[model samples]
Target chain A: MRFTSLSGLALGLALSSTAAFAGEIVLNSDQSDPAPKKAMEELIANFQAANPGITVKWNNFDHEGYKSAINNFLKANPPDVAAWYAGNRMAPQVKAGLFEDVTDVWEKNGLNDQLKSAAPSMTIDGKKWGVPYTYYQWGIYYRPDVFKANGVNVPKNWAELVAACAKLKAAGIAPFAIGSSQKWPTGGWFDYMDLRVNGYQFHMDLTGGKVAWTDPKVKAVFDKWAELVKPGYYIENAAALDWQDAIPQFASGKAAMYLMGNFAVAPMMKAGLKEDQLDFMQFPEITAGIPMAEDAPTDTFHIPSGAKNKDDAKKFLAFVASADAQTKLNATLGQLPVNSGSAKPDDKFLKAGFAMLSSAAGLAQFFDRDAPAEMASAGMDGFQEFMVHPDHQDAILARLEAVRAKAYK
Target chain B: MSAIAAQPDAPLAASWWKRNQLQLAPWLFLAPGIFAFAVYVMIPIVQSVSLSFYEWDGLTPDAKWVGFGNYTELWTDPDFWTSLRNNVAWLVMYLLAVPAGLAVALFLNQNVTGIRVYKSLFFFPFVISQVVVGLMFRWFYAPNFGLLSGVIKTLTGSNIAILADDRYATYGIIAAGLWPQIAYCMILYLTGLNNINSEQVEAARMDGARGWKLLWNIILPQLAPATFIAVVVTVIGALRSFDLVSIMTKGGPYGSTRVLSYYMYEKALSEYGFRMGYGAAIAVVLFLIMMVFITYFILQMLRQERDA
Candidate 1:
């Protein structure tokens, strides 16, 4: 098989010299940041330089537009390599056989040993499907200046956090800056609350359908969230704003804290806040003896089954998995590298965030990413409704149960 | 036959090409248009209808025929019912655009300074995309900082999150949708108004038919074609309203805004996993509902064609 494969490659090279190249191999991505786009262009330039016979073309769209366009593109001009989310988000596409399996490449490149923890999420059954580039943890971003002015410190536990919020409120500052209009922001609050109140195992069990949504452990998280909402700790008019738009309240000192992912840092800086002025802390402990966990959603790259250049795609994937590539990508994008031995920045906030996530015994993919999308849509809406009127817990639970039954089937 | 036989040796023989050219020329002219429409529109409609009976995620090689299982599921789904009810509300409320448009058209139809500028400005909303219109409305409905909320607060000391409240969310979005819809209707009416019979108006004036009677008796009948087109477009727009709902609320605040289109998208795509069969089922239901209105319109058009 090896001898035939080598000869076949040589024959193809000979034939290509006499014939015109087939066409351009297109690469599509949802990452719209200028830095990543430039890095990708550089990587493609390197690939084209190494492989002189093949040409590469590129198309990029933002997250929302990319989601809609992917299906259309798959049926029409499917790209060779595309960036997509992992876990249940990619399950449907994987099941449809839309992606190429690179298990052989995974072993050859030794990514299996390097990314042991990240490998399962990228695998369906026992087949490797994608190569991960970067992942980051989510936590509460707070103002150090507000904490200093109010004489409040970062809370280490659930009770201490409640007390800190009280102190902030007493000083006429909103304690939490949440925007529920986008619907998905409210989901992060639910996921963190569930993880802290129950445990990481329980969250997995509930999402995996082993435990029902109406279980008492899940109910307690909503109960606690309602308690927080009853008080005026969150910013006013949160229901009418997007998560990014809510940053103004924090920047202007109207709110003291925000629950967001690491991607939010760029927007915060764009809103005119310096890094020294802000900090991050994990969600406070809800269950006394339960181990700590953090939410880490990683972005990965996958090769479609229709790719004309499988060998080149594998080479690119192997190149992306290297420590140097991970570090360069994360440093340029302000995200944490998934590579274990990559060098990190010296900033206090990122260092503290790294320390917190490293110490965690488990990791929870964020709510929207963890649950199936159908369930998340209905589930997040229920969370928003419960936020407005906590007394409708029974009604909310019933509706979620109905949605879950249909979604899981 | 005798004429052909007599002309066999004459200069005026009827060739086969000449005899058939009249019949084939019309089809030749229509072939490209018909082929394009069949490929883009008719084929997709038929495929969606057939897929509605099957259970297959779009990626699977084979689809399982499940009869009316998709429709059966839709019948029991409360979200589907809610979306259908909202569609009914959108349809009824959207009709207000016809009269409202005519009123504006009449108001701006006068010969005054910069009247053309006023007309163009009034027609602006129709030209912008629905996504932009949704964003503008979202900003206007933002609770504390929105323009409408500010005005209401100054007058009534209360703030309403229009898009967040279940009761008002759909209505608020529909009103935003109506802004462009009304502009479109106004353009159609303005064109119709340009061609109204001036002789009839003058005769009505001699007969002392003025005010409401004069306008209703002499003008409105002539505007029937414009009104018919406006109502048809409005009904179709109301049914196909997925973008605004997806952008504004994503069928949220407790799934109160989950229209059938967004609901189908959530089921088939997104993180929901590929329930292609289920999504196709929802699409079939929506298509059937639209087909009812389309059939009625087609019948009406056929009657008008025969009369003409």
Candidate 2:
């Protein structure tokens, strides 16, 4: 018994000494999808190759499970680095002081200049809380073949879009294929309309709950939505289908256009649509002088406040921010690199997306990410309700205004 | 325990403890299970009750005391009322499972050829998980290409999206829930029917009791224990209807299918609101509802025990 006890004590000491000497960074990521998981693996391989002395232990979690798992782990036993979203999703963590400020890493590595587009989003109270590695642009993904068949030129303004929709309707095709059953697809529509009609500032204020849902500006945005909805531009019984379920309608030539993120390209291709057949376009100009803003939900990595290996964590963040690193990672991810100096993707769709996002006046992290979750849910519900029953717009707006008042307060 | 120590010098305390050992042994056997239940179940329930009186976002450590605030807010919340109404609908509609199960049991009780296989096949839905059951029902209720929609279109010349329509979504989900619940109730009655007092049934038939009269006067009273258990479990299942609703609609189509349990989950955990305090208040309300039934059940049992 004494010998066993003595050996246990010796083993514990040896383990402790090794732990104290060898630098280890624990990373928690929600990149369980095949493409992004491969990207993460390659990123860690390069990071380890660069820093031979440091070891990164990665804990991967499924997308839905990670949202709930994050709070428990961050408080009880936090990882050195964790993947999270930007904008209001990260705001709560920053406010709670759960995320470590990495402004110094950004300054020393010139990340502020390289990752310029995402810098404002990662900043909280003039300090950077995280390093964003990737983001994708949301736009109108349509069939060029369908446009040619209908004699519809790519819409350049609101009038052109309306005319194009009318032409498409005459040609026996709905203009948009949307599935608002899940409701986030409806959020994308609302985000774009608010961004186009009222510009980025109004979009931000409305999502931030600084503007009431009953505001006339908010009503005007809904009025534009009602025009398409009332005219039956979307698929019938759209609320019954999921986003993926709606993709089939667009791919089968039943629908002409889809307003979605760049990720839809893979599924669209898989559904037997050729790369040349499909095209990406910026949403048509709505208000002439407002410039253009887009939804670019950025994925980022941050050091938890309770992280043990701060130095190694900072090194990883710096590496993630580097243009070379981001370029390599985004190549595997099929997403745009957050770093501005990174090489533009060679894919035709991504090439178009990059150009559109690079020239955007601002980026609003999609409506759900910009607003608090409760308000976003209520707002999306209102949007869906408006879509199904546009006549009851006032009642829906009143309900939303009530929820916003309680949620924001 | 050890032959009562077998001597006078074994000490009086040992003898006394040993004398009372049979009485103590049953309690000693129950102690571990009782302790586990107290720790895991009772403690969390008490904690949740206390938590209802505070404002907690479920993440940060800084929880503010806000007595009765969450409850008062829930009183005016439309979502809360929607969930409550759906829960009532579920309770009323789910009772249909009991009578439906009885009908199926009666049909399948005969000793026909290959009856065992048919019975097993009918029991298949109950054997599978609720998640799979929900998915199967989702495909069945899918709007455009679903089997049910295809049938509706063929007959009525118009397809009805039951899961999408606000008026029918709850009923659609409840109907899915009934598939498995009816199978469960049928199995219970099947077992009860197997061990029935045959002599009493035979005597009742001889005394001019036939068909419906035979079933009402004879068989049902004998299956009282089975019926009681089925009602208890069905009531509990109705109240805790979360999985099917979650997998089917997620309280969507304007939150029309929201039930108390699903609403509580949304409030506490979902992307919508992590209002843990408010969720706990909702849970306390559900617990009170369950407690009403539980106390009634226990009181009934006690009264029966006295009569017996």
DockQ each candidate and list the results.
Answer: 0.48, 0.51
Q: Each model's number of backbone clashes?
A: 1, 0
* Proportion of native contacts kept per candidate: 0.58, 0.58
Top candidate on DockQ is 2
The residue-by-residue lDDT of candidate 2 on A1-409, one tens digit each, is 9999999999999988775556989999998877889999999999988977688899999976787678778888999999999988887678778999999999999988988878888998999999999999899999999999889999999889988999999889989998878888899999999999999989999999999889999899889888898998888788889888999999998899999988788778888899878999999888889989999999999999999989889999999999999999999888999998889899888888888887999999998889987888888888887888899899999999999887885
Query: Which tens-of-lDDT digit does each residue in A313-348 have in candidate 1?
Result: 777777777777777667767777777767885656
Candidate 1 regions with alpha-carbon error over 4 angstroms? A1-25, A34-56, B1-30, B269-273, B304-308
lDDT digits (tens) for residues B1-308 of candidate 2: 46755556566657788889999999999999999999999999999999999988877788889999999999999889999999899999998888888888889999999999999998999999999999999999898889999999899999788888888889999999999999999999999899899999889978989999999999999888888888888998999999999999989898889899998988887866668999999999999988988899889888888999
lDDT on C-alpha atoms for all candidate structures:
0.82, 0.90
Per residue, candidate 1 scores C-alpha lDDT tens digits across B107-204 of 88789999999999999999999999999999899887889989989999988888888889999989998999989999999999999999989998
Candidate 1, CAPRI quality class derived from DockQ? acceptable
Worst 10 residues of 1 chain B by lDDT: B8-17
> What number of backbone clashes does candidate 1 have, counting pairs of residues 3 or more apart or in separate chains?
1
